[model samples]
Target: MKQDIDIPKVEGVYVAIVNEYNDIYKTQDWNAYIINDNDDALEMVIIVTDGYSEDKITSKFRKKIDVLPKKSYAKIELMQEELFAVNNQFKVTYFKGNTMYDKVYTFRKNTINLKALQPVPLMEARGVLVK
Candidate 1:
């Protein structure tokens, strides 16, 4: 048996982006986890699991900071040092019925776009990685 773990409650935000070009059978969904929120900015983390299709590909960079109240569509660049230094390690794992795949990616600086500022159900909304 595994012991239960208590995770600290950190103020954060949840953002979800839907690809405009998704077809009926397959819809592309991208999520951004922005934790440690403050007045001016929030810590953003993006994790991607599937890369078999162009619409499903995502960057492995972590710990990005996006200034709040940004312009409707602006680009924010992320640095590797800042991402990894914050104790964030890029990890990916996928499991099928009888097969499992796991991989780790090298840290690389990347940029993500802030799509818009909108209202989310229960948290602050910060749209990112709009394609």
Candidate 2:
């Protein structure tokens, strides 16, 4: 009789850290479908929270961060010398490719915006990073 050799299991966790606007709890591709020329139909949502174990966060949200919508564009401002934790507070500014000429705004750390001020165009968003 042939027997399978059992290997020891190693416990671990997986994580991905993104600056400012994080789409870790959603699965919609809100970034790819919008055009910069239009701002009214902008239904962009963004979330920023303290980082956690991938398995834990995924299960709580019932989805993978990969399914989360990518930012159309992001303006990241590093808070400290390093980004050590998901909860580490940092300022962020973003644009969805339609409203306000793509000007970025500083949002409170550890929070999210279910919508943007407007849909901003890519071209308009390019030079509008107000820092």
Candidate 3:
């Protein structure tokens, strides 16, 4: 049986904290925010919370510090946008080293769940990391 779902036309920033998959390299999770979405391109900012060399140390010892996130923009040509009416899933694709990948970002019950599809390396190395 086919079911229909309502996909909202959302415009604004969506934030999420994605953890590293156990199958791949076990590293610290990062935060990703969808800053803008349009027909031309999608702008996003990714923040590495921990597990990376650069994120491990702090400027002031025993003190709290704030770090800026990296900005990335993916063009329409390099991505495939899909809206699933069945589950209200919104996905975007990008390529890395000739391999394509998709990341699904969906809103449910006022919460956003974003997942990076298989071939995680490409997504971290190219898709969200690409400037």
For 105-131, candidate 1 gives per-residue lDDT tens digits of 322222222334344333334433211
- Per-model tally of clashing residue pairs: 0, 14, 0
Ranking by TM-score: 1, 3, 2
Per-model lDDT: 0.30, 0.26, 0.29
TM-score of each: 0.23, 0.18, 0.22
Residue 123, model 2: lDDT of 27
Q: Give residue 110's lDDT in candidate 3 (0 to 100).
A: 17
Better lDDT candidate (2, 3):
3
Runs in model 2 with CA error above 4 Å? 1-42, 52-72, 85-131
Q: What is the C-alpha RMSD of each candidate to the true structure, in Å?
A: 15.2, 17.2, 16.8
Worst 10 residues of 3 by lDDT: 77-86
Rank list by lDDT? 1, 3, 2
- Superposed by TM-score, candidate 1 places the C-alpha of residue 120 at a distance from the truth, in angstroms, of 4.0
- How do the residues 1-131 of candidate 3 rate in per-residue lDDT, one tens digit apiece? 22553333434323232333334656443333332323333323222221112223212111111221223322221111221112222343332223333444543321212343222221352123211
